[model samples]
Target: MQQHKVLLLAIASVLLAMVTIQSGASIAKQLFPVIGPEGTTALRVGFSALMLWLVFRPWRHLPKGRNWRAVIVYGLCLGGMNLLFYLAIARIPLGIGVALEFTGPLAVALFSSRRRLDLLWVALALGGILLLLPDMRSVDALDPIGVLFALAAGACWAGYILFGQRAGNLASGGTTVALGMTVAACFLVPIGVFNAGSALLSFEVIPLAIAVAALSSALPYSLEMVALKNLSAQSFSVLMSLEPAIAALAGFILLSELLTFTQWLAILLVMAASLGSTLSTQKKPAAAS
Candidate 1:
């Protein structure tokens, strides 16, 4: 009974993290007209870094030697992922952008697996991507540039996962993430300031930017850590497969972004692929045993 309660709490934590992340994206989108996506990314990352440093004090365990290289690359990937994701969503609907970006991790999973069953997941993901391609004849077609940016963000996400593991091995999760966020802030804050100028410092924008940082990064990261502590990695990965759908629901409710039938189907296909891939990975170990 105690184990069941703990598992339930962990599941809830993961779900809450997804909702918080998508909610942050919805709020951040609101800032685009005021400060642009660049500015918004800057504020989100900058404030996130500040909050993390205060909480984790990662400076105490700085990465050294080759670990520094890993963390640097990890941080660059983290920064690039956020920057491109914001840019993508500025042009596309939040749900679609998230779904497209999810391909990065999905690709990482599929490529690492040699199992024949993985092909099914790959095919499903490919079908979704194909369906998302802009149809000039359709009034609701997605922007090509936005699609490219989202795909690029996904690539960065894959890199983040790969490099993050290396960095995580070198330090505690909190320390690695804190230092990584600091690196991201250092790289992105300048571009934001250049793009938004003094608007970033406006009284009106500050509060919302902080909220974006909290909702998107700080809170979710904390919750994920809790979930990670209590849950098996396979369970966590399977739960995370729900992210695109949660993002879609959040976009619809918070931003009033409506998806066309085909787009909705595409999102489902991607979600299905992600879920299948995660489950397959879990089964692999059991089968080998």
Candidate 2:
């Protein structure tokens, strides 16, 4: 009874987090025309760090010794992931960009698996990527540069996962994230300032930036932490597999972006691969037990 309710709540929290994050990305995209992607990344990451710091007060539990290195690297990965993702979405459809960036985590999951079943998931992911590749014969081919940027962002996401684990072990989840966001802001905010200059300080930009920060980072992170407390990691990863589809819907509703049949199929394949990887990984432990 109580456990069932908790599971339901965790599932809902993860779903809501996906929706909120995608909606935030859509809103962040709106800022690009006004401040450019560089400026938007600055405002989003910088304001996110501020909001996280206020809530977590990570300064009260600072990382000690070698842990600082882990947090720093985690922060760098977070910043690079955001920056590259923004650059990717600026050129490509938001859904496709998200799907591409998702490959990073997918690869991380698949590569770490020693089971033969994992090979099928890897193949599915590769097929999806192949479908997404720029084909000169196709009129609707995606921008190769944008695809590369998204792939790069996915790589950063993988790094974020690797380093974040180490950092998380050193402190509470909130503290690690808060500290990491601060570090991200330290470096990323300057690039935005250099690109957008005084315009970043405009009354109009600040409010929207705050909204972006809250929707994209603060609120979603808090909700995910709630979900994490209740859900097993395998279950969490399975639920997260839905992110690309949610991103597609958000992109369509907010940005009026549409996907072709092929693109939609690609997204589905990637989601399937992600789901398969999670399920297979769970099976391994169960069989051993």
Candidate 3:
């Protein structure tokens, strides 16, 4: 009973994290006209780094030598992932971008697990992503550039997962994440300033950016850390299958973005594949490395 309750709590934390993260993304979309995606990403990541540093103070003991390599790669991946994702959403709808980005973790799970059943899950996930690409002849087709950006984001996400695992092995989990985020801000802050110019410093933009950092970065990361500590990695990943769906719903409700029935079905298929892949595989203790 105690274990079951812990699992339930972990599930709830993951679910709440998904909601807040996606809601923050939807809200960030509203800022595009003023600061552009690059600027928004900078604000989100920059502020997140600041807030996390204040909370965790990872600077107290910096990683040295080989450990620094892991942290740098982890930080770079986070920076690239955010930059590409925001760019993708600038051209495409939020839900589609999220679905595409989700392919990273799904691919990781498929590649990591060696089971005959995993093939089916892989196929289902591929088919769902393919469904998002309607005929090029269609007037309402997704932007090719946007799709490319999302795909790139997915690649960075895969790197983030791998490098993050390494960094987790090297340092305190919370400290690792906080320092990685700081490095991410270092990479993005310059680009943001150049692209948005002085507009990046607009007083009106500050409040929304702060809110986004709290919702999308700080709170979600903290909750996921707690959840991961208690749940098996398989359980954690399976629970996260709900993210694309939650993002879709958030886009619809908060941004007034709607998807076709077919698009909705595609999202469902991917969600199913994500759930199946994690659940069918034997549970593994959450990797701290």
Candidate 4:
């Protein structure tokens, strides 16, 4: 029953993060024209850090040792991940960009996998990406740049998974996240200032920026940390494959971006593949490594 409870908690937490992120993607579009992709990334991270500091008071927690190093890595990964993701979304349809970004976690799954079924999942996912791309209907002129950024985000996300595991094992999950967010914020300021040229500092944009920070960075990261505590990495990975579908839906509703029927079917196939692979290894990870 304890295991069941934990599983439930993890699912709820992850779904909440997904919903928040979907909203965040739209908010980002609003800011992208104002600050450009990199600048918007900086703003989101900057204000998210500020909000976390006020809420969590990391200075008071002051964890020491290996956790600190893990925190540092977590911070870098966190900042870099969102920056790249937003940069991707700015240029491409959210669906395709998200599909490409799926590569990172897919790599992680394959690396840890030995099952024959996992191979099938990878193929399905690839086929899905191809369907989404095919002359890159879902992408814009800058979409390739977005793809590259999404890959960067995926890399960062993978790193976040790796280092975050260490951090979660070592300290209070919430405290670790709070501190990591603060560090990410510190790193983003100079980049944001460079790109946005003080325009981001305006009082008028404060409320909007704050809302973005809250919905996108602060709330999602905190909940994810909780979810990690109750969920295995593999379980979380399986759940995450649904993100493209979520993003597609959100893009359609929020941004009015639409895809062809074939593309939607492709997404379903990938999702099925992911679900199959995950379920096959439900009680156990693929275990190749």
Candidate 5:
């Protein structure tokens, strides 16, 4: 029953994450004509912070203690990770951005890997990135700046993974998420306002922003928590392999973004790396829903 529950959670997290990325990207595009990347990410995370705060009531607790320190770390990474990723998406195709973003967790997994066999997975992951890097005369102008944003996002993502773990450990069953979410929003909300202006305050963007907040932030975390209840850390990481592939497919289905055969192969290689690492590593502690 426990194993089965974990499996269910893992699958649910993958599907939800896919949907979250797809919807968030689509909404960002919609907001593009109006507010731009800074505005879009700001709205999404801003509203997300409100929702999390409402639920967790971070203000009720004093921040002078460990909670404040934990949130500082989590917020710093979360804010940077989101801002960079949004910038990356604004530059490149969503799928490509995600594929590159996977490098963070991949690097972490490989670095901590005990198995000599994991090197093969690293090679495959690197190969995937290589396949995506060649200049295609046929494709639209690629943004070198966007690629830089993605690398920046990748670095932040690694920080997110590491800090999240640290926060979780420090909180010891407390939900520190609200504090982190709130602080990240605080960091970005001002920039979004300056960039988007009163348009950020418009009624038209509200529903879409709410939907995006739920899809991208709320649902993914909830489902991931549920799944962690059942899966080992290694198994969970392996399952995350679907994130890039799903993002790509979501782009195709929702945003009318298409990919070349070479791109598809690149994604496949990354998946193989994730799978190999997951299967070869030892299990993590059971997750809590």
Candidate 6:
């Protein structure tokens, strides 16, 4: 019964985290005109790093010895993921961008498990993504560059997951995340500064930037850590698979962006495949013998 309760709480936490993140992303989109996507990425990363430092006091638990390598790689992945995602969304709709970015984690999950049934899930996910691809003759298709950027972000996300696992072994989750974010800020701040120039420092945008940081990074990250404590990775992945849909809804409600029926179906197919993959893995552990 206790396990059941924890699982329920984990589901709620991850759902809430997804909402917060997508909502934050919608809010960030509004700031694009003022700071551009690169600038927004910088503000979000910079503010998140600052907030994480204040909260976690990472200085007290700095990476030592060989541990620095994992932390560095983790941070670089985090930086690349955020920067590329922002760039993708700047040109593409938020929902589609998220759906595309998800391919990375889905790929990681598919490759990590040896279950034969996992291939079906991969096929389904790939089919769904293919459905979202720009039609060769349609002038209204999404920007090709944007799609490529989101795919790159997805790749970075896979790296972030792998590197994060290594970094998790070296320090507390919070400390690892805080330090990783700091390093990410180091990588992005210069690009933001160069792109946005003095505009990034505008007093009017500070509060908006802070809010984005809280919603997109600090709050969601904390919630995910808590959720992870009670949920198996399979369950967590299944729950997280709901994010693209949530992002689509958020985009519609907050940004007036609407997805076509086909796009919505594509998102559903991906979600179904992800959930199926998790359920299949749970039912058939590799060491069942």
If scored against the real structure, what TM-score would every candidate get?
0.98, 0.98, 0.94, 0.83, 0.88, 0.94
Candidate 4's error at 198, in angstroms? Answer: 1.8
Which portions of model 6 show Cα errors greater than 4 Å?
1-8, 286-289
Model 5 weakest 10-residue run by lDDT: 280-289
What total of clashing residue pairs does each candidate reach?
0, 0, 1, 1, 3, 0
TM value for model 4: 0.83
Off by over 4 Å in 2: none
- Candidate 4 ranges with C-alpha deviation above 4 Å: 1-14, 65-67, 134-142, 222-239, 285-289
lDDT of 1 by residue, 1-289 (tens): 9999999999999999999999999999999999999999999999999999999999899977777999899999999999999999999999899999999999999999998899999999999999998988977788999999999999999999999999999999999999998899998999999999999999999999999999999999999989999999889998898898889899999999999889989999999999999998888889988
- Assess candidate 2 and give its TM-score to the true structure: 0.98
Q: How high is the CA lDDT of each candidate model?
A: 0.95, 0.94, 0.89, 0.77, 0.78, 0.90
Q: If both were scored by lDDT, which would come out higher, candidate 4 or candidate 6? A: 6
Candidate 6 lDDT tens digits, 88-115:
9998889999998988888887888987
* Model 1 bad stretches (over 4 Å): none
- Superposition error at 100 for model 1 (Å): 0.4
**Candidate 5 Cα deviation (angstroms), residue 234:** 3.2
Q: lDDT for model 1, on a 0 to 1 scale? A: 0.95
Clashing pairs in 3: 165-289
lDDT: worst 10-residue window of model 6? 280-289
Clashing pairs in 5: 6-230, 9-227, 228-287
